[model samples]
Target chain A: MIMIILFVFLCHAVTFCQIEFVKVPMQKKRPIHLALYQIKLPLPGVVSILHRASGLLLFLTLPLLLLMLENSLHSAQTYASLVALFKHPLARLSMLGLLWALLLHLCAGLRYLAIDMHLLNNLKQARESSKAVLMASFLLMLLIGVRLW
Target chain B: MVSRVVVGAHYGLRDWLIQRVTAGVMALGCLSLAIYLALHPGLDYQGWRALFSGDAVRTFALLFMLCLYYHAWIGVRDIAMDYIKPVWLRLLIHVFVILTLIVYAIWSVQILWGY
Candidate 1:
């Protein structure tokens, strides 16, 4: 937990430092700074970024998920065994991560669907809607965690 | 420009339709299971074994698994396509998901048949 937080903070620090540099004449031309922070990236933008991040995490975590599902369905004995394994500390932690991933994926996927349907298009509404989706995802994940343990 | 937009919307509409249809099937299966379990709250291991031994229940269970797995696969694929950007990585992920789904389907069949 602390390690994850520190890693995130370290990442932000590195990114900030890289972006806050004094321009030095280099032998080669530097890539153009394309970050939109200078223009005040809004709440909707943050939600969009997180949507993509969560999706990528889900993609990377697919193998473990498939194995879990497969093992559960292998037989009655395997199913019972696997469910019992879920009582372990690491399993509980992973389940917590899964709950968060599921909530985020649902929230962001619903937002994408709304956008596809041409709803929530206005700037203010987009920001407000994204904020609402993010809050819902957080609350849903919290509920899942409480229910699990 | 117009053609490209039309093609995009076409695929979007198809995806939307498939997703909704699959969701409906999954909902029905889940509701049936929930109601059945609620009605038979005291079912023991042998009782469940006997119940699942019937053709109707076995077929229902198989179809339920298939629909559920397919729906989840579609959802996962859409999520991946939305996020993963690198061409090679995305392709690899997609292939891996497909393989996993295939393996899961086979496992589901085996479980349903008590193998």
Candidate 2:
């Protein structure tokens, strides 16, 4: 009888262990489609994304700008050549683009700074500020563009 | 008041502050440059060279370039952290970025002060 009881206990322990070791598959939900044109992001969100994009654009173009500055400062000949290059319509257009990017990035950066300081804490204030930023950037761009062209 | 315990790299505050400070410096530089350019419209080679010939302006320009390098580094590093998931690949990309930024820094110094 004791031997039979021991055998039953062993069987029970083995079955329990087997059950504990069984793997369960996790059920994951499908990801939502993130179509850019189909979805309308908030004004602040759009501004924020543009801020990042402008920053990246500025960073990528830094080397070229630096080279230009260096060449312009190097000597009279190089500086004259660069000035002549800038006289081209295409060069002026590109410069206008860079100018706009710089202005937009600066405005957005100031907005971020204000937000960080808790000056624009509320959603309404944030939205208004973002709109102001956009308007300011465009106005400044236009002013600079006139001179540039 | 209950104190909160935070873990992980905890680089957020420092990076944020640095970015803002560097941005401020760059803004000042840009303002000065803009004013000079506006004042001297149709600037020729001699005029342009004269603008950067000042010791004070050269120093400011150098400082601006250094700040720009740091600012770009932090910005790019944050982007890498957010988007790059694979550990080894992310690390490799980071190393590459650091190297490139270093080279740019050195080149900038040469360009600015080499003459």
TM-score for every candidate vs. truth? 0.57, 0.80
Residue pairs with backbone overlap in model 2: none
lDDT of each: 0.69, 0.83
What stretches of model 2 exceed 4 Å from their correct place? A1-38, B1-10
Q: What does fnat come to for each candidate?
A: 0.08, 0.50
Model 2 C-alpha lDDT per residue in residues B15-72, reported as the tens digit of each score = 7888999999999998988898898888877776676678787788889988988888
Query: Taking the tens digit of each residue's C-alpha lDDT, what string does model 1 give over B15-109?
Result: 66776666566557655765776688666545666776788887987776676566566666766566776767767776877787787778666
Error of 2 at B112 (Å): 1.9
Q: Please write out the lDDT profile of model 2 over residues A53-86, one tens digit for every residue.
A: 8888888897789889888878877877887998
Worst 10 residues of 2 chain B by lDDT: B3-12
- Model 1, A28-114: lDDT tens per residue? 467777788676768888887776666556655755765665565455776678768988989999778766765775677677668
